[model samples]
Target chain A: MSGKLFRNFSFLSATLSFFLLVGIFAILFTYAQDAMHAFGIDFLFNETWEADEDDEGGVFGGFIPIVGTLLSTIIAMVIATPLAMGIAIFLTEIASPKISKGVSVAIELLAAIPSIIYGMWGLFYFAPIVQKTVGGDGVGLLTAGIVLAIMIIPFMASITRDSMNTTPLVLKESAYAMGATKFEVIKDVIMPYAKGGIIGSIILALGRALGETMAVAFLIGSVMSLPHRITDPTTSIPVLLANNFAEAQDLEMSAMYYLALVLFVVSFVIISAAKFYFFGKKAK
Target chain B: MNRLFVNKLILGLSTLSAVIGIGFLFWILITLSYKGITSIHWSTFTNDLVEGGIRNLLVGQFTMAILASFLAVPLGMMAGIYLREYGHGSKLASVIRNLSDVMMSAPSIVIGVFVFALLVDPFGGYNGWAGIVALAIMMIPIIISTTDNMLALVPKELREAGIALGGSKHKIILQIVIKAAKVGITTGILLSFARIIGETAPLLFTSANNQFFTMDLNGQFPSLTVSIYNLATYPDEASRELAWAASFILTMIVLCINLIGRFVIRNKK
Candidate 1:
C-alpha cells in the first residue's frame, strides 16, 4: 500500500509537470480569441501593417511581419542548405579524421554562441560589408537572412553530418567496388539513405530562422510593410513581438497574443515536420 | 576515366564550403575581441548603462538566472525521474517525452507572450520574476530531455544492487541512481545555465531592460544581452563602443559556461 501510494504520488507529479505546456498553450489560445474575432480570416491576407499610435490600443495587422518571416527564412535556407550539406559532406567524407574532429568541434562551439552576439556582429561588421556590396545600409531583409544563414549553418551541418556518418559502410563499399567516383557514391548511395535527416535538419533550421528574434530584430529594418526587394526593410513575428510587447494595451496586447498564437502554431508544424524525418529512422 | 577529376572537384568544393563555415566563426571572434577589448574600461563597470557601467546588468543576469535555475532544476529532475523510474515505456511517458521535445524547439518570444499574460499582467508589471519564469520554462525542456537520458544511463546493475539490499524505489532513485548519475545531471544543469544566460528574446518583454541597475526583482531590470541589443542599434560611436564591450562580457560568460559544461561531460566520459 505504501509503495502504491508512492508510485501514485510520483505519477501525479509527472503528470502535473507535463501540464505546464498545456497551460502555456491554453493561455495563448484563450487570450488570442479577441483578435481572432476582431481580425477574422483576413488576418494573414491583409498585406498592410499599421498600428495606431493615436489611440492607446488600436487596430493592427501582422501580415507584413508574417511575410518578412517567410521571406527571410526562405532566403536563409536557400543560402545555407547547400552550403551546410557541403560542410557535412566534407566533414564525413573529404576531411581527414583529425581535421574533421577539430572542425566539427569548432562548429559545436559556434553553436554555443548566443543569438544576440550574432545580431551584434551582423549589425556592426557584416552589415557594413553588405552595405558596400549588396546596396542599402545593411539593415534589411537581406542582412537578416544572411545573419540567420550564418546562425543556422552549424545546426544544419551537424545534423546532416551525423546522418551522413550513419550511412551503412557496406553500401558505400559496394558503390566504390562498382568503380564509382566519390561524388557518385555520395549522390547515389549516402544522400539517398540520409535524405530524411538532411530534410529534417533543413526544416529545423527553417523553424529556427522563422522564430529568430533579437538578431533579426537588430538587423532587419523593422519597417512594417511588404518588402518588394531584398534591400527593402521588413519585420518578423518575433521581432515585432519583442519590439512592441511592452507598450501594447488592450486589443494591441491581444493582437500580440494572436500573433504569438500564429507563431506558435507555425513553429509547431515545422518542428513536427523535423521530427517526421527522425521518426522514420527512430522507428528502426 | 574522368571520375578522378569529378571526385577532386567535388571534394575541393565541399572542403571550401566547410572552410567558409569555420571561417565565419574566427572572423566574428577576432572582430568582437578587437572591438570589445579596445573600448572596455574600469569605469564601464562602475557607472550606469547610459552613463557607463554594466555592473547592474551583470547582477540582474545572475539573479534572474539563479531564480530560473531554482525553478527549473528540481521540477525538471522530478519529471525526469518520473519518466525514467515510475512511468518508463508507458503511453503517458511517451506523450510527455514528445511534448518536451516539441517544447524544446518552441519559439522563445512566444514564451515571452505567455509569461506576459500569466505573470506580467497579473503581477501588474514587468519584473525580474516574470523573466525568470520565461527563462525557467525555456530551461525546463532541456533539463527534462537531458535528465531522462542521463538517468537512463545509470546502470541497471546499480539499481539491482540497491534492490538486493532491500532498498525501496524512492530510496534507490534518490540515493543510488541520482548519485550515480550526478555528473551527467550536473552537466545538464550547466548546459541549461549556458542556454538561459545568453537568451534575449524571452527576457525582452519580461524583465524589460532598465537603464539603471537595481536589485529589486519586483522592478524592471537590466540584462547584458538586452542592453547589447539596445546599445548596438544606436547610430553614435560611444554607444556602439559600449555595446561591443557588453557583448564581449556576455559572450565570455556564455562561452565559459559552455566550455566548462563540455569539459565536465568529457571528464565524466
Candidate 2:
C-alpha cells in the first residue's frame, strides 16, 4: 500500500510538471495567433517598416530581415564549419591527451563569455579593423557573419571532437592495420560514424547563429532593406526586433511580434530535429 | 619522400589553425584588460552611474541576480525532480521535457519581448521587478535541465537502498538522493548565475536603463550589462573605456563562478 501511494504521488507530480511545460508553448502559440490576426500573412513577406505617424502607408515585408538572418548564418557556417572540423580532427586524432585537455578547456571558456562582451568588442575593435581592412563602412552582413563564426567555433568544435572521439577505436585500428593512412582512416571510418553527431552540431550552431542578437545588432547596420552585396548594410530579424520593439507603434508592435513568433518557430524546429536525431532513440 | 613531407605539411597547417584560434581568445582578454583595467579605481566603486561611476549598477546587478536565482532555483529543482524521479513514460513529462528544451534555446530577446508584453506594457512602466521576472524565466529552464541531469546520475541502487529503509519517497529524495547530488546541484546554480549575470537583451525591454541609483525592486535599476551597452555607444572615449572596464569586471565574475563550480564538482569526486 505504501509503495503504491508513493508511485501515485510520483505520477501526480510528473503530470503536473509536464502540464506546466506545455503551458509555456500554449502561451507562445496564443500570442502568435493574436499577432497573426493583427497583421495576416503579409506581415511576414512585407519589407517596408515605416513606424512613423501621419504617413503609415509602408508595406510590411519581412524578407529583408529574413534574408539578413539566412545570409549571415550561412556565412558563419561557411567560415566556422571547416575550422571546427579541422580543430576536432586535430584534437581527437592527433593531439596528446594533456594538450587536448588544455585546448578543450580553453575552448569551453570561450563559450562561457557573455554575448554582450562579444558585442562590445565587435563594436569597438572588430568593426574598425574590418572597416580599415575591407576599405568600406564596417557594419555589414560580412562583418556580423565573421564575428558570429568566431563566437560559434568553440561550440561546433567541442561537439564535433566529442563525437569523433566516440568513433570506435577498434575500427580505426583495423583500418590502420590494413595499412590505411591516418587521413584515409579518418575520412573513411571516423567521419562516417560520427556523421549524425556532426550534422547535429552544425544544426545546433545554425540555430544559435539565427537567434543571436546583441552581437549582431552591434555589427549589422540597421538598414531595413536587403543588401545585394555581403558587405552592404543590412538588418537581421533579431536586431530588428530589438531596435523596433522599444518604440514600435501598435501595428509595428504586432508585426514585430509576428516576426518573433516566426523566429521562435524556426529555432524550435531546428533544435527539436537535432534532439530527435541525437538523443531520441536513447531516450526510450 | 615528397608524399611523406606533404602529409607532415597538412598536419602542420591544421595545428597552426588550432593555435591561431586559441590565440585569438587570449588576444581578446588581453585587449579588454589593457583598455579597462586602468579605470578600476576606488572612486568608480563609490559613485553613482550618473556621476560616471558604477556603484549602484554593481549593487543592482548583485541584488537582481540573487533574487532571480532564489526564485528560479527552487521552482526549477522541483520541476526537474518531478520529471526525473516521477516521470517514467508519462506523456505529460515528455511534453514538459521537450518544451523545456525549446525554452532553453529560445533567444534571450524573445523572452524579453514576451515579458514586456505580459508584464511591463500592462503595468505601463518599466520596473526592476519585471526585469527580475524575465531573468528568472530565462534561468528556470537551465536549472531544470541541469538538476534533472544531475539527478539522473544518482545510482539506482542508492535509491533502492533508501526505499528499503522504510523512508517515504519524499524523505528519500530529501535525504539520500539530494545529498548525493549536492555537488552537481551547486554546479547548476553556479552556471545559472554565470548565465543571468551577462544577459542584456531581455532586460532591455523589461527594465529600462536608469542613470541614477535605485534599490526598489519595483523601481528602475541599471545593471552591468545594460550599463556596458549604454557606455559603449557614447561619443565620449571615457565612457567607452569605462564600458570595457565594466565588461572585464562582469567577465571576471562569470569566469570565477564557472571555475568555482568546476572545483566543487571535482572536489566532490
Candidate 3:
C-alpha cells in the first residue's frame, strides 16, 4: 500500500511539467482571444501601440518590441558567441588543469550572479563607459547587448566546455601523433565532434537573451520607438511587460497577454529546437 | 609557416577571451563591493523600506523564497524519482524529461505573467502567495533537472544490492539509491534555493512591492530585489545608495550559498 502510494504520487508530480506547460498555454491563449480577434496577423507588423483618447480601447501592436527583442538578441549572440567559444576553447584545450579549475570556478561564480545585479551594474558602471566610448546616451541596443553578452558568456562557455571535453582522448592523441598542432586538433577533431552541442549552446543562449528581463530592462531605455542605429534606444517584450504589465486594463490587457503568448511560443520553439534537433539526440 | 602562425594567433585569441571573461567578473564584483560598502550603514539593515532600510524586505523575500522551496522541493524530487527509478527508461519518462528541460528555460517573466493572470488578476491584487507560486514555478524545473541528473549518477550496483537483500523497490530507492546521491541532491537544492532567492522578475507584479513591513501572505509584500528595481531608478541619491547596498548584500548572499554548494560537492569528492 505504501509502495503504491509513493509510486502514484511520484507519477502525478512527474506529470506536473506537462500540465503546467499546457496550462500556461491554455490560459494565455484563452485570455488573448479578444486581442487575437481585434488584431489578427497584423499585430506582428503593426508598430503603433497606444490607447484611444478616452483611454478605453485603441491600437496595440507588437512590432517595435518584437523587433527590439530580436535585434538585441542578435547583437548579444554576435558578441557572446565568439567570446564564449574562445573561453570554452581555452578551458578545454589550452589552460593547464589548475588554471582550468580556477577559471571554471570563476565562470560558475559569474553565472551565479543574479540578472538584476547585472542590470544595476550595467546601469551604473558599464553604461557610462559605453556612452563615453560608443557615443549613445549609454542606454540603448549596444549597451543592453553587451551586458547581456556578459550575462550569458559563462553559461555558453560552460556548456560548450562540457561538450568539447567529451571529445575522445584517442582522437586528439591521434591528431597530435600525426603532427597536428593544438589549433588543428581542435579545429579538425573537437569542433566536428562537438558541433551539435556548440550550435545548441549558441541557440540556447539566444533564447536566454530573448527572454532576459531585468538586465535588459535597465539598459534598453524602455522606449517604444524603432532604433535607427545600434546605439539608439528601444523596448523589448520583457521590458515592455515588466514596466507596463501591471496597470494595463481592457483591450490593452488583452494585448499584453497576446505579447506574452508570443514570447512564450517563440522561446518554446527555440528551446525545443535546441533540445530535440540539436543537443538532445547528441546528449543521449 | 602560415599554418603555425595561424595556430598561434587562434590560441592567443582564445586566451584573450578567457582573460576578458575573468576581467568582467572581477570588474563587476569590485564595483559592487566598492559601491555596496560605501553605502551600507547600520541603519540600512535596521530600518524597513519606509525608513530606507532592508529589514522588512529581507524578511519578506526570505519568507516567500522559503515558502516557495517548501512547495517546489518535494514535488520536484518526486518527479525526478519517477523519471529515474520508477519509469525504467520508459518513453513517458523520456518525454517528461524533455518537456521539463524545455520548461526549465521558459522565459521567467512569462511565468510571472501566467501567475499574475491566475493568482493576481482573478484575486484583484498582488499577494505574497502569488509571488511564492511564481517562484516555485521558476524553481521546480531546475530542481527536477538536478534531482534527475544526480539520481542518474548513482551506481546500479547499489540498487542491485538492495534487491538482493529483499528490499522493496520504493524502499530501495528511498534508502539505498537516494542515500548514495544525497550529497549531490543536497547541493542541487542549495543551488536552486540560491537561484530563486535572487529572482526579481517573477515577483515584479505578483507580490509587487510594499514600503512597510508586513507578514500577511494575502497582501503586497516587500522584496529586496523589487525594491532595488524601484529604488535604483529613482532620481534621489539616497534611494540609489540604498539600491546599491541591497544589490551588494543580495550578491554576497547568492555567491556565498553558491560557494557552499560547490564546497559540499568538492568535499564529497
Candidate 4:
C-alpha cells in the first residue's frame, strides 16, 4: 500500500510538472492568437512597416525581415555545412585518435561562447574586415552570414561527427575489403549513411540562425528594407523585435510582438522538423 | 604515389580548416584584450556610474543574475526530479518533457516579448525586478533539462540500495540521487549564469536600459549587456571604445563561468 502511495505521488508530481511545461507554449499560442486578430493575415507576408502612420494604420509587412532571416541562414548553411562535413570526415576517417579528440574538444568549446560576444566581435572586428574586402559601408547580409557560419560550424561539425562515428564499422570494413580506396569508402559508405543526420544538423543550424538576435542585431545594419545584394544593409526579424521593443511606441510594440510571434512559429516548425528527421520514429 | 599524396592532401586541408576555426577564436580574444585592457582603470571597477564608473551596474548585474538563478534553479530541479525519477512513460510527463524542449529552443527574444507583456506592460513600467523575471524564465528550462539529464544518469542500483535500507523515497532522492548529481546541478547553474549574464535582447524590452546606476530592485538598473548596447551605438568615439572594453570584460566573466563549470564537472568524474 505504501509503495503504491509513493508511486501515485510521483506520478501526480510528474503530471503537474508537465502541464506547467505545456503552459509556456499555451501562453505563446495565446499571444499569437491575439496578435493575429490585431494584424490579420497580412502579418505573415506584408513587407512595409509604417508604425507611425494612422488610417492605413501601422502596416506591418514582415517580408524584409523574413527574407533576411532566410537568406542569412541559407548563407550560413552554405558556408558551414561543407566545412563541418570536411572536419567530421577528417576526424572520423583520417586523424589519429589523440588529435581527433583534441580537435573535437576545441570545436565544442566554440559552441559555449555567448552569442553576444560573437556580436561584439563581429561589430568591432569582422564588419571592418568585411567592409574593406567586400566594399560595403559596414554591416550587411554577407557579414552576418559569415559570422553565423563561424558560430554554427561547431554545432554542425559535432553532430555530423557523432552521426558518422555511429555508422556501423562493419560497413566501412566491408567497403575496404572490396579494395575500395579510403576516399571511396567515406564517399560511398559513410556519407550516404549519415545523410539524414547531416540534413537534420543543417536544419537545426538554420533554426539557430533564424532565431539568433544579439549577434545578428549588432552586425546586421538595422535597416527595415530587403537587401538587393549581400552587401546591402538589411534587418532581421529578431533585430526588428529588439529595436522596436526599445522604442516602445504602441504600434511599434504590437508590431514587434507580432514579428516575434512569426519568428517563433517559423523556428518552432524548423526545430520540430529537425527533431523528426534526426530522432526519426523515436521522436514521436 | 598519387593516392598517398591525395590522402595527405585531404588530411592537410582538414587540419587547416580546424586551425582556421581555432584561429578565429584566438584572434577574437586577442583583439578584445587589446581594445578593452587599455581602458581598465580603477574607476571602471571602483566607483558608481554617478561617481563616474560602473560599480553599480556591475553589482546590479551580479544581484539580478543571482536572484534569477535562485528562483529558477530550485523550480527547475524540482520539475526535473519529478520528471526523471518518478514520471516514467506517463502522458503528462511526456508532454512536460516536450514542452521543456520547446522552451529550450524558443527564441530568447520571444521570451523577452512574453515577459514584457506579462510583466512590464501590465505594470506600466520597467524595473530590475522585471529583468530578473525574464532571466529566470530563460534559466528555468536550461536548469530543468540539465538536472533531468543528470538525474537520469544516476545508477539505479544506488537508488535500490537506499530503498532496501528502508530509506523513504524522499530521503533516497535527497541523499543518494541528488548527492550523485550535485556536480551536474552546479554545472547547470553555472551555465544558466553564463547564459543570462550576456543576455541583452530580453532585457532590452523588459529591463529598460539605465544610463546611471540604481540599486533598487523596483528601479531601472544598468546591466553590462545593455551598457554595451547603449555605448556601442553612441555617436561618440569614446563610447564605442568603451563599449568594446565593456564587452571584453563581460566575455571574460562568461568564459570564466563556463571554464569553471566544466572544470567542476570534469573533476567530479
Q: Which number leads on DockQ?
A: 3
Candidate 4 yields a Cα-based lDDT of: 0.79
Model 1, C-alpha of A271: deviation from truth (Å): 0.9
Writing each residue's lDDT as its tens digit, candidate 3 over B127-218 gives 99999999999989888889899998998899999999999999998999989999999999999999999999999999999889999999
Clashing pairs in 4: A18-B96, A46-A61, A46-A62, A47-A61
State the number of backbone clashes in model 4. 4
Regarding lDDT, does 1 or 4 come out ahead?
A: 1
* Ordering by DockQ: 3, 1, 2, 4
Better of 1 and 2 by TM-score: 1
Determine which window of 10 residues in candidate 2 chain B has minimal summed lDDT: B1-10
Better of 3 and 4 by TM-score: 3
Q: What DockQ would candidate 3 receive versus the native complex?
A: 0.88
Over 4 Å off in model 2, which ranges? A1-39, A55-58, B1-10, B89-91
Which digits, one per residue and each the tens of the lDDT, describe model 4 over residues B114-216? Answer: 7777778778788888899888878877887898889988999999999899998877888899999999999989987897887887788787667676777
DockQ of 4: 0.43
lDDT per residue for candidate 4 within A14-37, as digits (tens), equals 454345434545665665564467
Error of 4 at B163 (Å): 1.8
Look at candidate 4 and tell me the lDDT of residue A238: 90
Name every residue pair that clashes in candidate 1: B44-B53, B47-B53
Q: Which ten residues in a row have the lowest lDDT in candidate 3 chain A?
A: A275-284
User: What's model 3's lDDT at B194?
Assistant: 98
Model 2 per-residue lDDT tens digits across residues B1-269: 66466557666766776886797689778877787798676777888888888888888888888999988887788777777787745776777777777678787887788778777888888889888988988888888888888998999899999989988877788788888888899899998889898888888888867888888767677888888877888899779877887899998888888889888887888
- Compared with the true structure, all predictions reach lDDT values of 0.86, 0.81, 0.95, 0.79
Candidate 1 CAPRI level: medium
Number of the top TM-score candidate: 3
